[model samples]
Target: MPAVTADTLTLPRLPDLPQTATAWRPVREVVRAREFLEGEGFRVRRPFPGVGLANADPFLLLDHMGAVEYGPGEAKGAPWHPHRGFETVTYMIDGALEHRDSAGGGGLITDGGTQWMTAGSGVLHSELPPQDVVARGGLFHGVQLWVNLPRAEKWTPPRYQDIAARDTTLLSSGDGGALVRLVAGDVAGFRGPGATRTPITYLHATLSPGARLDLPWPEDFTAMVYVLAGRGTVGPERRPLDEGHLAVLGRGGALTAHAATPWDVLVLGGLPLNEPVARYGPFVMNTRAEIIQAIEDHQAGRLGRTQVPHVTAADEELS
Candidate 1:
């Protein structure tokens, strides 16, 4: 399959239907993200295990860190870490995150940008605030998602997809009241820029007051929506959802949400990987044995060495 690139990709048409039936999936549960300090004292809210992992197969974890303004020298993002058997996606919403890894992969993901790093075999990396952000002080907000790789593809070569804010696919609702940004899936007629090993759909949407979106979704995929801001109603039942809450959707033909106020939400879903999962810290493998191997490899310096080079203005400006 071809990689989702800037020039090679085209917008797909929205699925046509005979009727506008709102077969929205009902919200199964509303859960809150567990707050914790991770990666050199950076605060984060995790919403997965707190809710339930079985409903979120292929997606192991989600860490939402800050929409808060940081004082000078206050930001302490993730330091050196190791990962394998899955992919880590960093989506920046407010500040800049400078990343450097053992596999010679490094970049600066600024506001509205993303860095999709596939830690297939193994890799050591760090995600931290840039010097400018730390020195000058600014708002810091972002989400880090762990995407599980099938057992057969766990050892694939690692790679990176750095997508700038401008390069992402942005689509508007029919009435132009709702804006949808496609990062890694098909939304309406638009497809995201990142290619994936597993079939998944990830969307970031913002709706004006009274705006609504009825999204066509695959029935077989497990879907959920996380509210980032404002208030909204979801599914055929129009279950009310508030900020900082995650709503798991049941099986349905489509996923829908209507904004009661200006609302911001993230939609994520993927085909389930019905396999045993053994996870330890950053490593996720099929069995405890594989997890042990990953740890041993890192301790023995097999993952690779960390390389931190200064990010130039030109490098940070890449789209």
Candidate 2:
């Protein structure tokens, strides 16, 4: 669960909120993530899309990978695949993953690093554990978020970004009660390293027991908080939120999280695209016809050529 770490006392702190100056966002619902096997049969807890895509507008899916410890030969990863009309943000919180796409845009995304890939138009990509992870066995945990691209940018181009741990903008709570790692978009006045095609803010935060986070938020964005580890409460009403749970928030210019114990959570929100979303296995589009076109394009090899490179033990030693 070491997504990113820093001594709060030594970091820049967020400005304290005035008691009556702003409003605390209220909790709309707390949805528990349902477990599903993804990418070569690795288990992940997905919290939305099941809740309905309308609730997560501009965002299609949220997959929470393991905090599970894997024995030798038990690790798994996503096989080569195709995507279009959206972006994938894969954040490695505890282990390493190798990402290679047809455009040759990827690398080792290990502890506290991230791989942001835009599948605009379409592309073939594969996500696999580095040979060492599968051979020697260790802990592997991460998150993959699917951000929808606007219709205008759907065919922009396929690209990628490798955001290392040190590249994240770090901040702390007013009283140094929590640590914040800004991954994308703006927070107050500070910004993250991720360059998104849509308006959004993504961040990971760790709070000490009994600590509370008062975050300045954009009123135009839809907000939600997902607990990664430990227990916590969200909103002014103090609604309960535990691990694998997501709290969808209501309108306000600010949000709050009060920890019951040491907790790690991801806070994200984005301007609602308010557009129709038609999706299938891996393709996301604005209409069923578009989705069909995507599948046809992929089957016709328009996405990109698939190159399955089986990693060998010797490869691990060299890497």
Name the best candidate (by TM-score).
2
Give the poorly placed runs of model 1, Cα more than 4 Å off. Answer: 1-22, 51-55, 305-319
Give me candidate 2's TM-score against the actual structure.
0.94
In order of appearance, the predictions have TM-scores of 0.89, 0.94
- Name every residue pair that clashes in candidate 1: 12-189
Error of 2 at 20 (Å): 2.8
Worst 10 residues of 2 by lDDT: 307-316
Task: Please provide, for model 1 over 62-112, each residue's C-alpha lDDT reduced to its tens digit, 9 standing for 90 to 100.
Answer: 888887889999988888888999988888888889998875668998878
lDDT of 2 at 201: 97
RMSD of each: 5.7, 5.4
Model 2, total clashes: 0
lDDT of 2 by residue, 44-118 (tens): 999997943335987999999998798999999998999999999999999899998886667899989988888
